[model samples]
Target chain A: MTIPDTVEAREAVDLLDRTRALVQPELRGACDTLPGPMRRVAMYHFGWEEADGTPAAGAGGKAVRPALVLAACQALGGDPDRAVRAAAAVELAHNFTLLHDDVIDEDVTRRHRPTAWTVFGTADAVLAGDAMLALAVRLLAEDPWPRSAEASARLSDCVIELCAGQQIDCAFEERPPEEVTPEECIGMATAKTGALLGASCAIGALYAGAGEREVRAMDAFGREAGLAFQFIDDLIGIWGDPERTGKPAGADLAARKKSLPVVAALASGTRAGAELAELYRGPMGAAAVARAADAVERAGGRDWAQSQAAERMSKAVGELARAVPDLGAAGGLLSLAEFVTRRNR
Target chain B: MTIPDTVEAREAVDLLDRTRALVQPELRGACDTLPGPMRRVAMYHFGWEEADGTPAAGAGGKAVRPALVLAACQALGGDPDRAVRAAAAVELAHNFTLLHDDVIDEDVTRRHRPTAWTVFGTADAVLAGDAMLALAVRLLAEDPWPRSAEASARLSDCVIELCAGQQIDCAFEERPPEEVTPEECIGMATAKTGALLGASCAIGALYAGAGEREVRAMDAFGREAGLAFQFIDDLIGIWGDPERTGKPAGADLAARKKSLPVVAALASGTRAGAELAELYRGPMGAAAVARAADAVERAGGRDWAQSQAAERMSKAVGELARAVPDLGAAGGLLSLAEFVTRRNR
Candidate 1:
């Protein structure tokens, strides 16, 4: 149960490898009863094949969430093998949100291929996502997991919170600029991004017979980790290299996305904030995007976001330290948390 | 417990009325976190308010699904009061599907008002639907009932099957006419419609500690009832008057929906079949829709669908008889089944 280092995190890698085998088959098995086009689109997203149902590879995601689940279970004196299904369930739920989020965001590409909606159409994508969520719940319900009742309840609450958070995100997009405050944005992000991560860790701990207080502490750690991850993601959305980020630099600027950094800067009331706000108020074009990025930078948005991310990362690590004293096999959990907070892409 | 006749069915109706009081507040409590516009749309769909968020009476649905759940429990000599939360959960799940389905189908109106999607936009509508689904699962998991594990598993499985059925329905829309068979259409309808109803009855029975055989029989009854209900709906989709159906006559025709009746006629090799296929090959204008409706009729699609509906209804009655010989206080359940098949709208 030795924890692997960041450079040699083969345990985490193997967990993801196992996750692909465990989850993709169940997913495909569920979709096998469906018609061809839907099966194809869903399969493609699962990284099994192409839109035409051709054999393909390297279409998988980073498996960040599942790794956290397994790692947290190990950290809490449980075998990762014992928590594999929980790990798989969390990943399935995570992907479910991604599929639907892509549709809601109207993003055509994911992981360097046409999205499920783009390939099979939006309705199919929506249903496929729904199917995945249902499968996640089913997996948790019918299993060797000792606390299926508690796990299922936790998972359902996370999902509901996730959707409510998504609704807030969508509604905020249509509102006037002043309506979205930094605190509100943080609240939305916490519910949207943090809830599932928290639930994942809590489920893992619950499976391991962790005490209620211990489970809550693990959940708090995971939640803080998730917020840190999202905060860094917001920073990366603006300032990261295009090659590393997989999209164009300043893409958030072009989309006029009010990320955490942007919101904080906008609320700062500096001259640069006024300029950034003015640029955002008008239609976002190429030149406007360039000027807006510059304005945001001058308003200290990037620095402020970086500092906030650092603070969150510190808080997350502190919580993790408080929750798991021995570390043991969960030392990998620490590495995974660092990976999430520090990753460029 | 004494069985109530249609005139005395008001007793069950009274139970439903009382249950609605509990559900409405809980439903709103779950949705309170959502932003104003999205909450407004959901409120409208919940029949709690008008599109403008103004208070309005007479906006609610019949709550038939919940009634079935409670009645099934009562029929099995279980306390209907104990099943109230689950009843609300099923109804919420039903509305969740309806909200998402409207968006996927590009439907602007439902229950003679603008759909949530049309009023609040697709993203918000989708998120709201997702929230409802999560809330439904949460309620099932949290509700204080005996046999909670079995109930949770049944609910999750039903939701998964429901999504699978929806995926097949969407996939059917994209397939060529030759590939769309009547059996396939029936399977889709079962998955989409039958699964939830079956799950509702089974869950209620399970909560009541009904024998496994009885639970299975109740599920069978629900499945057959759902098929019968859908068949009648297909018939009404074509021939029922707009005043009765609440939709324009031939509305399904204009949409070129591959419903049961249409699929049945397509399977039959006849002159009318050829004409119907030709008409469905392209968009159906008003005149073309009328022509297609006539073509289906000439091909005996109308008569064929009616016979199918009657056969299914008979089978459903037989299953219900086997499930609960006396049916006790659920005499209203039998009447509801009959009413479902006979309803014009």
Candidate 2:
């Protein structure tokens, strides 16, 4: 079923809650090993502590990457407990990217609080991000399981892909609106968003003692689902409810970000596409942002992104079936994938 | 001899040149694998290419860390050729730290050229640095040698130490002149400079199939030598031949850096120490910088650092004896260590 029933949605949220419970203790244990100054920034960045060093309720990630790791391992009949460290490693890698990306983007707020860089200053934040990445590799490399080396290698490679993705995305911002192609935009999005998600699954499969074929299929499954999630996310960037998103409508357009749907609209070769590109050339006011959103829809970017999301989700299931022949066994992974795309709906 | 004889100095140069020849090909091959944008920044950072991406005579690092690795490998009676990738990995990790450090410190020059962050902008340099760090881990993790796992883990741990060191160093800049202790400065220097150098030797030993005792001794040797080098470097930062050092005399004093010797002088509890602390309270012009330099010397910082260097070098040789008792087997390693401390003279 393309649509998640209300009960299915509840199950997905429950799975995420269970993953947070399963993964947080080990994650905290790992953070405790950081040197004092770095430990302070990292603890605050993860929302385990306030910037003042007091405990907080922790508005960190939804643990999607970690959940995917454990779910993939369980789907393959592997003990999820054995993969907890790997799950934590994946989450650390994810947060490392977030910290650096925030500094690079100069975006201040994250998880409804100030970003690490804003609270700790850019130098401490950058150093903390670097430490988190090295910590991720250390956790995997120190594992007693022989296959952990492979997982570490895979994660490092994913980190490189992420840096490239973020680099390209930043480069895109400096170029003329018409200069970027939809293909290039998609490639950047895949590198930035999908690579780590896929790596999380592949690492999970490796920990489950899966061979090359199964691991590759699991990676493909996660990548497809991740892209699907990205498409939905980009849609929300343009048309998200201000109350729900906690930002203005068309916030991405206001910033003139070369997001997926906007890139599609710019390259659509319609009158609206040309108008949208013209509007992108200057600072956007509220009226301009609203008009830009309308032009994107008229240029067919909205329809295209929606259909692509649905198509990608379909492909994701196909890949999932290849990795896990028994669909029933993959319930957790399916729930996670759906939960990510179901956010806007 | 505390000072290198003419032949000994020549031998040290030759060993470094040989290490460069052996490691450059693998390092280039590894760098060539980076994505397009990152490859450009990394190439320029390593001085392999001009900013326009044209080939240039590289003015990169002196290949000190890689030399340590190969020399330590040979000293352990292992084939140094087998450790080339690990040597390259260590160098990559070193440069990764350099790129980010330059950004954080806002230093404009490195290796007598504009730093990567200055040339390519901060975001690209940071991304390139992130990629290089991952590439370092990837290089070791991909090695078929079973011991590469231990080496990779060691390198990751070293990176974390480096981050912590840099973080603390930056924090020191924010505190009052009298707030920091010399012991804390030494700890930061050991973490920042000594940890990676020690890791290089330890990893070399691991690749050579050395046991725990030999590896620990080798690491100690590198750490002591690294601290000695740091003391000499700090002395040069304050007082050195401007022509040879490629900067003004008292460069560190002018910048108000909380380098080791400066911290020592500030904590000296003497009249000149109070005068130096007063000078540190605000920005220093040329005349003020000269006065600060005189105050530090009058506070006994210069003599303290020189004596400490000699003491650390003695300890380094003692540690080297434990790792390679034959002594003759470690000629190259010994030469490299002596050459680093001999820079001031």
Candidate 3:
């Protein structure tokens, strides 16, 4: 079916689910090379098996990153199967970051389940993440594809940026809200969230023998989409349903997280923004959490973030149109971007 | 002058010192590409800077690993300069492991100074280590050399082994000594310590345009030397002087570390070994530490480790002779093995 100009939310979700099913087997196969214990840790993290190795119908991540890889390749007139390794590699690298990020952030729950660190211990979880990274690189290096070097280099560069972004994010936690600038927050989010997504699309283009210009265009598309995704994510952090996000209601406020929306609200310099900043400075009781959430929305944070996401998504679609020219070929990619930006609303 | 058949300890030390000086510049240059904070952390870890960024003659590590890379290249009739990138790559990867291992092991001191984890916060230290790993891979991948692919692959594989070894090491800490086999200890040591050394020599040989046989032989040579290095390191953990080693006396015993010698002692099935096991089961006071040390030595753990190291050194020298086909070219490698096997003593 040729997707329409505007994909419905139901259609986008179905497309993501179908692509995830296609990608999960490749992802699992990549782990087959890992050692026994490390493989178990990865399997558990992917929700392929329970901690004790029992089969469980686990909810893996959205698989949006890998879907982007395949969709970008297809849009560039390449076979999706040829880009499978790139897709799997991007997915592995993404999960590797998540596994380590959880340990570094001391987050206990992901996908409504106990984290890998909690189940396998910190050392094993961290090592598993390391192994996955190596595997990701190996997947690209070991592939017999001609452009493997370029693909690998792009992925490595993206990972370095991811690390830098994460470093800044962790540093931000120590700074007062007044010292944290919106530009800095956006830069960190770009590096942390955008770089990988951009690389995923760029790597797909490289595999499809796309020219440098098209590759760059695809990267720009993914980057803007990634930014939009983060905007919505930050919004959800402040107001997401606990059932949908698998996190506590107002969890970001309770933790006093300086997410993008919260940063924007604090930077607004309005009365509600000042009141929200005050609420953030003190210990967050149930009342304080609810009040902080209300204050953030009242300070124009919610509206600002929603508008920012919409603007970025519009730019992302424009980039995709520029790169592929044939809008029909880009339908899958566009819908995936829509799903990512609108999820958890 | 060509090296003599028997290199005296003074000559060996001079050779190591000279090569280390040559490699340090490349090592520092490699860090130039790191982001500011990460670069600072790396500089401080290498003793190039203080925490506040002031210059210091910090005690960097011995640089033995990089020396092996250059020496192996020269010994195999390749230009040492051609192997400089490989040498720096290996050193960076070694430091990467040290940075993370210190955090995972919760080790407070290294090379007589507070470890990177203690200097930087744990989160930054971990991220810094992650950056270094990416940088290491980038170094190999960016080099336009013909063998860069093989070298990069070797390094990635070695990193996987390192992670596996670390995982096993941490898992061992949770198990009783009796449940941990000597074979497992040796396997862990081989993976944790030997894989990188093997890859170092293999990469050096690769850069030198060596054949498969020569590369494998060089890897085998370094692997044996690495085993010898670990044996001596374990011995030092048990019996080295506090003045030179910069650790508390019998620190390994006090912490009940299942180092090779300790594992060997526990598996000895001798009376002194039994006493050591009994002592290990309880909290270690100063007296208990002293007695544990005595028991390890009396149970033939110390002697067994020494003999094993000597045997491995002999085998390493044999592998070098096989690879180079001229005992004269191998003198540097032989002396390095000797230095590593006898440093603490």
Candidate 2 reaches a DockQ of 0.82
Error of 1 at B293 (Å): 5.4
* Every prediction: chain A TM-score: 0.90, 0.96, 0.93
Displacement of residue B300 (Cα, Å) in model 3 is 2.4
Fnat of candidate 1 is 0.59
CA-based DockQ, model 3: 0.62
How well does each candidate superpose onto the true structure, as a TM-score? 0.89, 0.96, 0.92
For model 2, which pairs clash?
none
| lDDT computed for candidate 2 | 0.90
**Candidate 2 Cα outliers beyond 4 Å, as residue runs:** A1-5, A242-244, A281-286, B1-5, B281-291
Ranking by TM-score, best first? Answer: 2, 3, 1
Tens-digit per-residue lDDT, A54-84, candidate 2: 9998846789899999999999888888999
Residue pairs clashing in model 1 are none
DockQ of each: 0.50, 0.82, 0.62
Q: Where is the poorest 10-residue window by lDDT in model 3 chain A?
A: A1-10
- What is candidate 3's lDDT per residue for A178-239, written digit by digit as tens? 57877899999999999998999998898889999999999999999999999999988878
TM-score for chain B in model 1: 0.89
Clashes of 2: 0
Using alpha carbons, what is the TM-score of model 2?
Answer: 0.96
Ranking by DockQ: 2, 3, 1
- For the predicted complex of model 1, DockQ is 0.50
